[model samples]
Structures are given as C-alpha cells and as structure tokens.
Target: MFAKTQAAAPVEAPKATGPAIVPGVIDFNVPGCKPEYPRASLRNEETGTVVLSVLIGADGSVADVKIDKSSGFRGLDNAVRTQLMSGACKNKPGTVDGKPQQTWTKVQYVWKLD
Candidate 1:
C-alpha cells in the first residue's frame, strides 16, 4: 500500500463580529416596553418614577430586572418589577465582534395621575 499523506494544515475559524456600531449615542429604541399604570397606585393617586436595572439577553429577551430606585411607593416599585417581568421590556442586546451579548441598561417608569 502507498504511504499515508500528511494531514492538511489547520484552518482557523472566523471570529464573530458583533452588531454594527454607530457613532454618537445611537438610538437604541425599546421595541414595545411601556410600563402600565398600577391599579393600586392609580387608585391611591401615586405619582413618581421607578428606576429599574434591567439585563437584556443577546436574543432581545429579558434576562433580569430589579428595582434600582424606588418611586417612593412600594406599590409602584412592585408594579415596575411586575411590568418588567411581565415581558414588556425588551430590546436588542449589545454586541461584541459581531456576536450578540448581554447588556445592562436603566429603565424608568413614570407614574402620574391623570
């Protein structure tokens, strides 16, 4: 039998280039994430903004959401958490090397009486 030929050289795999980049504060629009008015808060005439620390997954999904600052009303704070976890807050995640990545962002829910 003939001698075995040498193996082929190893080929490097292509790197993952993250999402496109835009200069100067690109508009990262939140698809459809609006906090609804909390029934309890509305009934009590509560008005304030709840700041939330949200973690978005690479696939534009909500990974985690927590209250960074309360709206001075426990009901409002709870409502914010509820709203976020209720699948209302979602946006395109940041990217690195053309690959999607998890990103942290802040979202404020303003509760005002009509």
Candidate 2:
C-alpha cells in the first residue's frame, strides 16, 4: 500500500496568451497517487526529495521514468522507482487541442521520517 504525497501538485507549462505552445495546458496536480517510503528506508531514516522526469503516454500511463534527482540512498531511490513503476503514481495524461497527448512532466517525491 502507498500513502498520498502531501503535495501532489504538478509543474505544468505556462498558459497560452496568443496561440498555445507545443507544451499546452497540463494539470500537474495528480491526486490519489503518492510514493511510499519503504520500510528499509524508514528504518534507516532516509529522507530527501526524488525528482522524476516522467513520460506519460496518451492513455495516461507512465511510459517511462527518469531520475532527475535522487535521495542519495539506494533503497530510497529503488523504492521510489518501484512505487512509480508499480502504478502508485499514475495520472490522467495531459491534453492538447482537446485530445490526450503524450507529455513530459516532472514529479517530486519528498521522503520524510515521522
């Protein structure tokens, strides 16, 4: 099971003033999905923000994930990757011209110990 990230907000492209850009409207806020801290990481008190560059397909599935930044712990990094690959961070794909289109987006997972 996974817990929801406190801030699931997305970093979307800027709005259109004139004509829309290749990077159209994107809803970075993907609710209901969050990365979970693995027990190993928790036991070791590992915490940091894992920045991810994700490629979302037209169907809203996570097609690929690249670690833009890591938490510096092997366990944490693996856990974050696993969580995302396992569909814990899936979201609705961004759209262009009122149609679902593949898009590149950034997601950050801040792991904290409580």
Candidate 3:
C-alpha cells in the first residue's frame, strides 16, 4: 500500500505599513503645517524646539495638540500649537498594520533665526 501526499497551503504576504510619519518628518513642508514665526519671538531672537503630542484624526486632520515640552518661550510654543489646531495642517494619518487609524504622535518644531 502507498501513502497519499497532501498539498501545502498558500501563504499570504505581510501587509506594508507604508511610510511612517515620525517626529523627524514633522517640518515646515508638512503640507499645510508651516507655522509662522511669532513676531515677538523673532524680535527677541528666541529659539528652541517645541515638543508636542498631537492627535491626528483618521481623516488626516489635527484633532488636538498638547505641548509636551515648551520652547522656553511661550510665544514659540503657542505659535506652533495654534498652527496645528487652526485646521490648517493637513497631516497624513498614522497607520497601524497597514490601516489608517486615529493616533497620537510626537511632533517637534524648531524655532531658529535665519
């Protein structure tokens, strides 16, 4: 008597999570996220990095923003926050397992004089 052989099942490929939008990606060219330098800060020559915890909606809109770390200057911090919350920044939503999801991500904005 001969034994029968079974066929192997097909395996599916892992899904791609696409491009990540980490803190390093947050910059002046982030679509509508270009924050104008505060006039007071500009005149005072204040420069620092403002760290923020931003909640992005699945529809690619900034839902909320909280300052994780201030830039030492209230004007700079407020400027960055205002820009994000003003519905002007159209961010690409963060993805999980290749699917768009509402997520909170850290964003850093650096204030520097040219």
- Give the distance in Å from residue 70's predicted Cα in candidate 1 to where it truly belongs: 0.3
- Cα shift from native, residue 61, model 2 (Å): 0.9
Write candidate 2's Cα lDDT for 7-110 as tens digits. 76899999867633232222334553555678887788888887878777777777777898887887877776676666545566777666778887787777
Query: In candidate 3, what are the lDDT values of residues 6-91, reduced to their tens digit?
Result: 99898998998776643212455876788899888888899999999988887778888899999999999999899988887787
Off by over 4 Å in 1: 1-32
Candidate 3: stretches off by over 4 Å: 1-27
Question: In model 2, what is the error at residue 34, expressed in angstroms?
Answer: 2.2
TM for every model, in the order presented, reads 0.65, 0.68, 0.74
Model 3: pairs clashing at backbone N, Cα or C within 3 Å: none
Top candidate (lDDT): 3
Q: Cα RMSD for candidate 3?
A: 7.8
Worst 10 residues of 2 by lDDT: 19-28
lDDT of 1 by residue, 46-103 (tens): 8998888777777767777789888899988886677666765556676655667777
Candidate 2, which segments miss by more than 4 Å at Cα? 1-32
Task: Kindly give the stretch of ten consecutive residues in candidate 1 with the minimal lDDT sum.
Answer: 21-30
